[model samples]
Target: MIELVRPHAALVEAWNEAHREWGPGLHEDGFGIGAEDDVDTIEGIQAWIARTQQESGELWWIVEDGEVLGGIALRSADDERVHRFGHIGYGIRPSARGRGVATWALGEVLRHARSSGINPVLAFCAETNAGSIATLEHHGAELEAVEQRGDTRVRRYAISY
Candidate 1:
C-alpha cells in the first residue's frame, strides 16, 4: 500500500534513491527543495528535512512498503507563489509511474486542503505534462486557462472542496 509520511532522517537512503532517479536538477516539485537547499550530502539532507518542518507549506513523502516513491506538497493559498504555482505540487519517480500513485497522492492532499478550509485549490502543470493533466482531471479539476509562464506554456486548473 502507498502512504504519505513525513520526511524523516530514517528515510534518507530511500529518498536519495528517488532523488537520483530524477537525475540532475531541483525539479522535485512536492519536496519544496529550493535551489539553495543542498540535498547531496548527509548534513544537507538532514538540514533540508529540518527545513520542511519550518516552511509554511506541508510536504509528505509517497512511500510504499519501505521505499520512497515520490513526494506531495500542499501550499497555503495565502502563499504569494500560489498565484503562479498553485496550491499543490507533486511528482512520482520514473519507476513508480502508471500505478495511480499520483492520483492517490493528489486525492490525499486535496483532502488535507479541504480540512484546512481551503475551499478552492488552484493547480498548474506544463501543458505538455499529460500525466499531471490527467491526474488533475481525475480529481475533477476545472481548467481555468492555459497561460505562458516564462518559456513554458502552463495549464491552470482549480478544484473546489
Candidate 2:
C-alpha cells in the first residue's frame, strides 16, 4: 500500500506535522520550519519543491493511503562527494518504524533508479546505525567500502538494479 509521490505544497501541513512528531531538525532543508536556514513560509516550501524538480534531484513522499509516512530522495552522481555519501537518502516516521517501510521504500527507489539508467545505486550509513545497515543488507546491498567522514566511519553499500 506504499507509494512514492512528488512533493507538493498541498502536503506542507502534513509534512510539518510529521516533522514535529519526529522532533527537530529531521529535514536538512527545514521544509516547514521557520528557521534562518530552513523554509519559513509556504511560498518558500513551494520554491524548494520547484528547485528539486529543476536540479535533476527527485524528492518524493512515501505515502500509504493518503498520509505521508516519510520521504526519500534520489539524485544523479554529481561529484566525488556524492559518490561517498550515496545517491539516495530516506527517513521513515517513528510511528512507522520496524514495519518494513524503509525496505519497501528503498525497493521502489531502486526500481526508479533502474528505469532511469542508473544501475547499482550507492547507499551509505554510519557504522553505528545498525538498523540502516540491516535495511540496506535486506535489499541485497553489498558492503563496498568503509571510509572516514570527518571523525565518523561511514559504511558504503552498493545496491544493484
Candidate 3:
C-alpha cells in the first residue's frame, strides 16, 4: 500500500536518493534534492525540507513499505504562471515507473483534493510525455488547452470533481 506523508527528517535520505535518480532538472530547483552543495549531509537535507514545507503548498512523499517511491504536490493557483502550468503536479521515480504507481498516486491526490473541496483541479504535462497524458486521461481529466513554450508544448488538463 502507498501512503502520503509530509516532508520529514527521517525520509530526507530517501528523498535525496530519489532525486538523484532524476538528475539535473528539479533536483537543483531548491525543492527537489539537496538545495545546496552539501545536500548529502543531514543539515543540507534538513534545510531543503524546511524550505519545501515553508513553500506556498503541500508536498507529499509517496511511500510503500517504508521506501519512498515518488512525490506529489498540490498548491493554490495564486501565481500567474499557473495559467500555463497546473495547480497540481506529480512525479514517479524511474525505478517505480510502469507499475501503475503514477496512476495510483494521482488518484490518491485527486481523491484528497475532491474531499478537501478543491474542485476542478488543474494539471499540466509536456505534450511528449505519453505516460502522463494517458494517466490524466485515465483519470477522466478533460483536455482543456495546449500551450506552446519555445520548442516544447504543454497540455493543460482539468480534472473536475
Candidate 4:
C-alpha cells in the first residue's frame, strides 16, 4: 500500500541515496525534460521537500512497506505559474523499479487530490516516458498537449477529480 506523508528527514535520506546512485533508472526519458531536476544530496532533497510541503500543501510520501521503495510528491500550493493548476512528481529507486509502486502511489495521490478539491491536476511527463504515460492513461488522465522543452518533447496530461 501507499501512504501520503510529510517529508521527514529519514525519507529525505533515502531519496538522496537512491537518487544519487540511480536517479534516472527506467525513467531516463524524464532525465532533463518534463521531470524533476537531478538531486544529489540528502540536504538538498530535504530542503526541497520542506519548502514544497510548507509552502504549497504538498505531501511527500514513501512508497514502501517498511522500506522506501520510492518517493512521490503531490503539490497543490500553486503559484502565479500554478495556482489553478497542480503538478505531481515522483520516482522509484532503481532496486524497486517495475513493481507498480509508482502506479499505486499515483492512485493514492489522485484520491487525495479529489479530497483536497483540486480537480483536474495537470501533470507533465516526457513524451518518451512510455511507462509513465501508460500509467497516467490507465488512471484516466487525458493527454492535453505536447510541447518542447529544450531538446526534449513533453506531453501534458490532466486528471479530473
The model with the greatest TM-score is 1
User: Could you tell me which residue pairs clash in candidate 2?
Assistant: none
Give the alpha-carbon lDDT of every model: 0.93, 0.74, 0.76, 0.63
Write the residue-wise lDDT of candidate 1 on 10-107 in tens digits: 99999999999999898888888899999999999999999999888899999999799999999987788888778999999999999999999999
Residue range 8-119, candidate 3, lDDT tens digits: 9888778878878877555322133433435656887777678778776667898887778888877655645346556678888889878888788888778777876667
Candidate 3 vs. true structure, TM-score: 0.85
Write the residue-wise lDDT of candidate 2 on 1-161 in tens digits.
88888878777777766666777663432122224434446777677677766755577888887778888777776634357547788888788778988888888888888887776788888899787898899989999988898988989988885
Candidate 2 lDDT for residue 154:
88
Candidate that beats the other on TM-score, 2 or 4, i.e. the better one = 2
Local accuracy of candidate 4 as per-residue lDDT tens digits, 1-161: 55655556766655455555664444522111123533455555555555555555455555455455665656664544343223676666667767677788788777777888877887778799887887788899999888888898988888885
How would the candidate models be sorted by TM-score, starting from the highest? 1, 3, 2, 4
Candidate with top lDDT is: 1
Runs off by more than 4 Å, candidate 2: 26-37, 78-81
* Worst-scoring 10-residue span by lDDT in model 4: 28-37
- Cα lDDT of candidate 2 equals 0.74
Off by over 4 Å in 3: 27-41, 77-81
